[model samples]
Target chain A: MRYEVDWSILARPELAALLIDGVRYTMIVAAVSTGVSLVLGTALAIARVSGSGWLRWPAELWVNLARHIPGVFWVLFFYFAFPELLPATWGSALNGWTSFALAAGIVALSVDNATYVSDIVRTGALAIPRGEWEAARCCGLSPWQQWTCCLIPVTLRTVTPPLANRTIHNFKNSSLCMVIAVPELTWATQQIESLTFRGIEATLVATLFYVTVALALGVWARRLERGGYRHWRGAGAVWRRERGELARVDSRR
Target chain B: MVELISVTKRFGERTVLADVSLAVQSGEVAIVCGPSGSGKSTLLRTLNRLETIDAGDIRIDGQSLYRSGLDLRELRAKVGLVFQQCHLFSHLSALANVTMPLVKVKRLGRGEARAQALALFRQFGLERRADAFPDELSGGERQRVAIVRSLALRPKVMLLDEPTSALDWCLRAEVVANVRALASRGIAQLIVTHDLDFACAAGDRFFLLQEGRLREVDNYTLACCAPEALRGLSSVPRGRLQAVAA
Candidate 1:
């Protein structure tokens, strides 16, 4: 038996709608997860650095545990096992909800992505000189103001390229949600294959979507490193120039 | 004015500052100099409460530093500290480095903070370098910017730790002039340094910290004989040094 490719099958109205819905859900999960994980990860990184053991230890434990586990396990666990842990009626209600899989997917993805971001951001924070902290404190800026006005901005700016790359990885990981029947882009491709036996065309389209978006994100990360943006958006560029100039002056002296 | 009333600090079983008493009048420039491990830096840090004392009291402008209900932010804002490395915020332009604290801590409007920062920049001859980042500036430029940043807070007392350590002779002279300018403005200064020339040129009074004890010495003694005398006293314990001085 030979496999015949028919690209026209995707033109069917119902099939097209399913693919459209799949793209929408895929983007929603990716975008929302990225936003949530960036915030949570930054906070977690700060917590791990805080002077109090209460904040630091718990944050350390969470990052360590989440980092070692696989992303698929988190997705499945949240979808299949989490509802069972809730109270009986609530568990049943959660299981009965139509969008439960989508919610679970977002939570699982966010949990997994945040650990990587936390590690990256913490590295940037530590790389800052001890002098910066002393300067801020000596100026009498409150601890909260110090973090917001100085530390967080510097750390996040320094780590933008790696953070952007992680976001791209998380966008691709949205495909993992299909295991729990979340019906994202990959699931739509499979559905099209199953119904009309035109899996090739659908798979090609889905692959193109992933490749195109991922490439765009990669270009953005590069531009951030190179200062391709008009605003003072490239902190890494500025940091490099600063180091280079200082080194040149030191040698002359 | 700044005062350290019998300020004492200990680390584990070792004493870093022992019964050290000193004062700087409103327009005075006091220099503290000593051999390495003699706690010159520790003595400076204690004034800003960067190092808490095991016992003793510190007062800036007649208000006790460690008093209950005293706001540390207020205390720090009143007594500015410039470090040996002049740790300017590398992420900000020199102008922003000064203005940020003004806007954030003093609640100055942005325009007001900019004007104040620019005025200091002009006074220090750093107006041309205001847009430069800390790393982009030379060592002298960076140190001046750091001092200007602290001054923008309008501190009553300024503490400088090894200001001339990283500078050439020309820059050292610039710092001496700067210290004199600060004193004329009535900002009392406590400078920690090993440069005897800088101390003699910039200080109104000189102090020596040896074996954790602070003692005032004349500028001539510090500049001429203090180095040889300090070397001779290195082996003497605190008690023996006190007995010998007596």
Candidate 2:
């Protein structure tokens, strides 16, 4: 069978706009989900290692559940079964909402990625010597101070490669959202194929989008690992500000 | 003053510290000698409440650590403990590593902390290495920074667990000099080490910990068993301030 590739479908303004919207939404979901997962996943990681069983058990259960289930199953479950679990008013409202699919995709992807992110965080935390934690404690740093300055930085530095891998995995996982009619890049490709019978051209554009973004993030993550990028501008005085605040309270003349 | 009255600690079925009682007075270098696993480390940790005692009480400057309403962070600030491995926060520079506790625990302004830290760094001759990270430093340098971190808080008592284990003999004299400087300032020192040579250098009130039991031991007896006494070894490099040590 001879394959005929048609590029005419993307030439029209409206069709082009649809693909652009798909790209935009896909990036938004990836970015927002990554941010949410980073914070929540790290918290879960700390809970998993906490001395109290009350904290550890719940975090462990979450990681285990997410790990055992496939990614597509989670997306579909969120899109289908999750709303029914909510209160009737919210459930029905969400079901009827125009952007419900995208919302569901973000929630599903964030948590699914969070489980893996937590594991990465846990391993990174464990990799640090216990002596470092003890050193901070003996110096009289509060639990919050220790986590922010010492623990978080070590975890971020040590697990940079794995974190980057996980993030790219998350971006790829956004494709799963298409199953719920979220109209992400992959869904847009399928729509263009159905309408114009030009599946190859649409699929090519979608693939390029995924590859470029994923590659760029991977590069950025590597740079982050090597200390090639500093996230906070004007963060130099942040610690000094903490000291200044302390001085005001304690009357350091 | 620091006092441990009938302090006992157990891990599962094993008693690591048993009814161990001791005191360290201001400006005194109280050394505890023990073989590996004799609970010397645990004794130091107990003073700072890093290792919870299964029985008895610890009093730092006349206040019972066991009593409620005690600000643990403030208490810890008054009693600084350094680990055997130096354990410098690897992510931070040497200067930041020392200043973090000052900012977080001591609540000192950056100006005050920086001034104090820089002064100590100069006193200890570590000013050149302030910006270096832990991995960038030698073992002696790392331990010195750890000491600086503890000193920045101006603790009433400083406890060190096997501090000299990480340093070469040449560095040991330097460390001993630093400890002497700290002692001169009237900060009580409780050092735990099995190295008789190192212990003797600071053993003003030398003691021994054996099988969880602790008792005062004499300096001459400890010097008899030093490695140099056995094999005539003097690892302390020549021209390494032997006169100052004398």
Backbone collisions counted per model = 0, 0
**When superposed on Cα atoms, how far off is each prediction in RMSD?**
6.4, 5.3
Error of 1 at A161 (Å): 4.1
| Per-residue lDDT value at B59 in model 2 | 93
* CA-lDDT, candidates in order: 0.86, 0.82
Winner by DockQ? 2
Report the C-alpha lDDT of model 2 over A124-203, residue by residue, as the tens digit: 99998988888778888888788887888877888989999999999888888999988789988888888777789989
Per-residue lDDT over A37-96 for candidate 1, one digit per residue giving the tens place of the 0 to 100 score: 998999999999888999999999999999999999999999999999999999999999
Candidate closest to the true structure, highest TM-score? 2
Structure candidate 2, residue pairs in collision: none
Residue B197 displacement (Å), model 1 = 1.7
Model 1: per-residue Cα lDDT over B1-246, one tens digit each: 899999889999999899999999988999988888889888878877778999989888888888899888888899899998998876677777888899999999876887788778878988768767776899899999989989999999999999988899999999999999999999999999878778889999999888889999998777664444566333224554455456
